[model samples]
Target: MGRGARETVLGTLGKATILQIPPELQDLTRRFGEAVWKRDTEDPQRKLVLLKYLDGNYTNYMQERTRFHKSSFSLEILNTSRQERQLYEFIVSKGPEEKVWQIQLEVYEPVSDPSIQILGWALVNDSCTITLNCTAERGDNVSYSWGSWDTSTSGLCSHNGSLLYLSYPLQNTSIACACTASNPISSRVVTFNSSECSYEQRGKFPRTEHLVLLVVVPIVAVIIITGVFTAAHLAMPIAKQEHLPLAEDSAVHTIYSQVQRVESPDKEPTTVYASVMMPTA
Candidate 1:
């Protein structure tokens, strides 16, 4: 057959010419015949030779001029797609004894590169919740895994599936987080730095609130204290001046009352009695 025709047939069979036959098709080799044969190269136009076992010798059935007669033949096909059945037919007894063989093949592709995304704003200080997402572009029978490497301590943490929750007090240095996409055929991984992630404030109070506490509160207190001290200082001189005259007036009134009492004693002589004591040498 032409190269195009062979490729068309192989494509219809859903098989690649370069790869090995899948394990599900291994039974077909025994069912067809003991000897299994397949193409070793990627050339689509390569001849497909079938060997027939008869009369204690193997004969090439594709050769029209061969002297050996054909009874049973075996052929092996490789690199078939999964969950598909293909049919093969050949003439055995020339007229009505033609038989057909059916085989099922299963093939899987390698896992594609895993994609990693931060679910929300990630922070190192444990102020906010952080999550990670992992996905694969294409694969068959695939699974996901997550891991992180502590750059400071060379420690490793592993988890399964597409989602991972991160906790606080992360490593001091940058952390390498990875997502791996795996399948029976192959696996792929992707990595990113935790330090590159963005962080957001989740608390009701923000850094600005802290700044207000640190700066504005002390300033307001100082202003209030200064105003109180200024008001007290401004009132002290007024209070002293208003009370000084009252004290002097009370002293003068006491002396005047004593002199008047001695002068007017209801006509009785209010005399001042004095006793003189002599000092003897």
Candidate 2:
């Protein structure tokens, strides 16, 4: 099956018909889905059941299409690759979150050498959200295989045909979505890395580099402020060491002197004087 918006139904295509489907196509979700999708297609599943499931998927697809294009468009699946990986190729065109079905479904003839381009992204804020559109340059029907190159961070990334989301939103990470576009005739591969789009990324938390600035910048500011304060404090003395008012600031702040008098009786004034300064404090 092709990658639907949420559920990547390994779409077991039965056959295509142009007849008017009953409004009861909704009923097929339970009864019709249980019959065909329950197991891999046997005798290629029931034709009527698959058609009902297709209608449900197409209904969901149309809702998305109506948002961007009010006009009608065409989609055709080359029924050949359904067994290549027992998989299906979503025929998509340009735009963001382009419908996995892109347009209504039809069985197309096999074409060759499909060139692919990963186009615009549609982003939103949640855990993580980004949509990558993969379009075939030449062939419209080809399988798309998406994967993560980094085995260590593989679990963090989730992808469908064109949609990519990360389990963790704010962190340092390099995520890649590669689509191996192949058909019965030839195959080609194209890839895009989220890291490459820092210049173009959108959303609440597009990159983790912002987180680094949030944490590191304030610490550096505090260190600089403290250093400046300490320098300014040292630049001006709290008080001169020679002018300390507290005696406890130093062990010695007292001095003793002795004076000798030689002439005692005659003048009562003959005395020798010597000047001494208390050790600079």
Give the per-residue lDDT of model 2 (tens digit) for 109-205.
Answer: 3334333343333333433444555556554366655666788666644354534443334344466656666555455666666664343355444
- Residue 102 Cα positional deviation in candidate 2, in Å, after optimal superposition: 37
Clashes of 2: 3
Candidate lDDT scores, in order, read: 0.50, 0.41
Report the Cα RMSD per candidate. 22.9, 20.9
Best of the candidates, lDDT: 1
Candidate 1 C-alpha error for residue 274, in Å: 99
Q: Could you estimate the TM-score for every candidate?
A: 0.39, 0.27
Error of 2 at 109 (Å): 9.0
**Model 2 misplacement above 4 A:** 1-128, 156-162, 165-170, 196-281
Top model number, TM-score:
1
The global Cα lDDT (0 to 1) of model 1 is: 0.50
